[model samples]
Target: MATMQECPRSPEAKLGMRVEDLWDIQEAQLSPTEKLNACFESIPVSAFPLPSSNQEVEIKSDATLSEAVKILAHHNILSAPVVNVDAPEDASWIDRYIGIVEFAGIVVWILHQSEPASPKSPSTPTSATAIAAAANGNTFALELEALGLGSASTTSGNFFEDLTSSELYKNTKVRDISGTFRWAPFLALERSNSFLTMLLLLSKYKMKSVPVVDLGAGRIDNIITQAAVIHMVAECAGLQWFENWGTKKLSDVGLPLVSPKQIIKVYEDEPVLQAFKVMRKEKVGGVPVIKSGSNTPVGNISLRDVQFLLTAPEIYHDYRAITVKDFMTAVSSYLEKNKTAFSMSCEFVTCKMDCTVKELIQLLDREKIHRVYVVDNNGDLEGLISLRDIISRLVDEPRGYFGDFFDGVLPLPANSRV
Candidate 1:
């Protein structure tokens, strides 16, 4: 909401006063949120991951699914726009966007296709059976030194070979698995909208990123992601902001409350496909595992675990038959080989229910993750928190508590740059 007048003017116009002095004078006129929003809006979309003209990363609908995964991995992205270059000559500009392709969508499509024409039910245990199995102490116990703790299984080497050599994956088109954005209303932001508005959109929809549209041309301008938002707050804001936010507990800051019934989870004995079912249904990146008869969380599995598909296509060939435990171990083995700090056992970062907002932010920043599970004093999973949830809640705080920073302040013009 800041205007040119609110920014530091040139030295010639300020006479003997320095630009720093003028900036401080103008900065005093806005609230903390507005000042932060102005700081964010000042940044350009091109500086981050703008995919409009990039050919290497941007994909067409006809590209093979394997090709798509390779591109995403090469660029280190989770999704991208599925552009349609062969639009009808008579088609309107708005109809040209087509849809989006995400890793989750690809997983869903592949799983759907992997089903047998007359599928045999997987030996996945039901909730009751799983609990019984756990009580019998027959459940797989993780050991730090064993293959179960994320070490790649020496027995599964053939699994990868079978997958990459399969004809099913080689001929499958990316378009077949891509989700139509129109179904979700294709959430797009105007290039002119403030970064605060962008944050609200992503948080409201639980999206990792949203496309920025050049509304006039009906074309995507860029994609803004949660990572970009974190970058803005961390690099643009000063230490005073963090200290100020630290004093407040997470409960006071309006994160969605966590309840046992609402927590999406998987049994330790279930087929790995069940975990994917939970993720597809809930649109979540991960799910916690709970032992039968216990309220305490034991482990977690996520889409990141599925990234092994890009390198070890064999993982996909056996994914439907693979148990969640087996998949986690394979991913762990892969990460160890790549020298990443994460372990399937160590990746489930958690915080106590009473932790401060500042504490949550710090953990996320240090780990470079999007969320943390909030647990009670007894170590029971209570809720989940994400970077987007934190940013949205902070920005949406009631303005009454800040007194009248908006008083006597003129609204910035609609076309204002900064």
Candidate 2:
């Protein structure tokens, strides 16, 4: 009776019994996928970045490649929808919406430019009219690179020397690379589409961001991202589910999820372009750099590292001769030289196969990275996990969440960085 007379409560506990009852009701939902989807729909499209009246982030098709890079870096955006300036005055707003210029697309342009000019088939000078036509054709090829719609080469030569030497990277118009919305196609989703529909579209298309078109409103209103999906699942799904999933070792997590054909890795001594090629072909953001003749991971490279090329054009000037080491070293040097002035770390995050999945997610959240490389007992490369992989798994294996609560505790509280 005396103990029951007084009890202390923390600030969060200060809420009335009704509040706790409401939380219990919300958490009682047993269908994880349905609960996750409901949570996603509850979030407005505006939760992520949306175009403003100024639309300052939109890239103009007429802008130069250099300008496009600057805009992306300056705004900390990975891609932007290319808007057509030359659309017929009377054209519908949707018609002016062209393809997107992703940072990965810029990597393609860089790799292409780094290649030595293939010896042009010997040709004679032509009439001015004919020269103009050929110039237009060349422009079309450059535009293809701009749209990130080129294939990797089996031939061992640089393919972009002509484009670079002509000062096209610095002067070529973005519209030329915008390609047609018909060729590359502006894949869009409606604002009213279900959360499952958006997730399916992202997974099927392997897109980082898909524009949400409010057609009835006649506007490309907002965007949905893999990150958004991850966040929703993490928040709505019970913490017990995350803890249970996290307790499983990474080896079990990655190997079963990634097929052999999906594994993309590069060697330490290989040309950086090789890694970029793998990224482009596989549509991955990063690749583990390993030792030759072995899977032992030595380092990793990502599109974030590629962005450095835009800042230091000189390093890219020797793009063809530079190996992956040279590029990594340059990035290290740049970061080291500026570390005193900026809060940045160049270290690549890696995890052993024995580590728990929760540990991997914690590292991803802590480092603000998209993917983490999984290594074997010998420190050899094993597999990788990305935000997309996590989101896809949640949708495909919602039943995985039905299990006993984990007694193991997290080293740190979950912070939804991704």
Task: Give a tens-digit lDDT track for model 2, residues 1-418.
Answer: 1221133132212221222233335555456445445454443444343433325368888888878877886776667778788777555546767667866676564444333323362132222223323535555444434433233322122333333334656777777644411125456766655455566556644667777876765556776666644443333222443554556776554433663346787877777757776776566678877778876777778876766655554544545455676678777877787655333355777776677766655566555567777666677666677777765654442343323322331222131111
Error in Å for residue 157 of model 2: 16
TM-scores of the candidates are 0.67, 0.67
Clashing pairs in 1: 160-314
Q: Residue-wise lDDT of candidate 1 within 16-131, one digit each (tens)?
A: 12222323444777875665555445533433444333542467778887787777766666677776667764454346655667665665554433222232433322333343
Backbone clashes in model 2, listed as residue pairs: 61-175, 112-160, 115-158, 116-158, 143-177
Per-prediction tally of clashes: 1, 5
Evaluate model 1: give its lDDT: 0.56
Residue 313, model 1: lDDT of 57
Candidate 2 least-lDDT 10 residues:
409-418
* Candidate 2 residue 43 C-alpha distance from true site, Å: 5.6
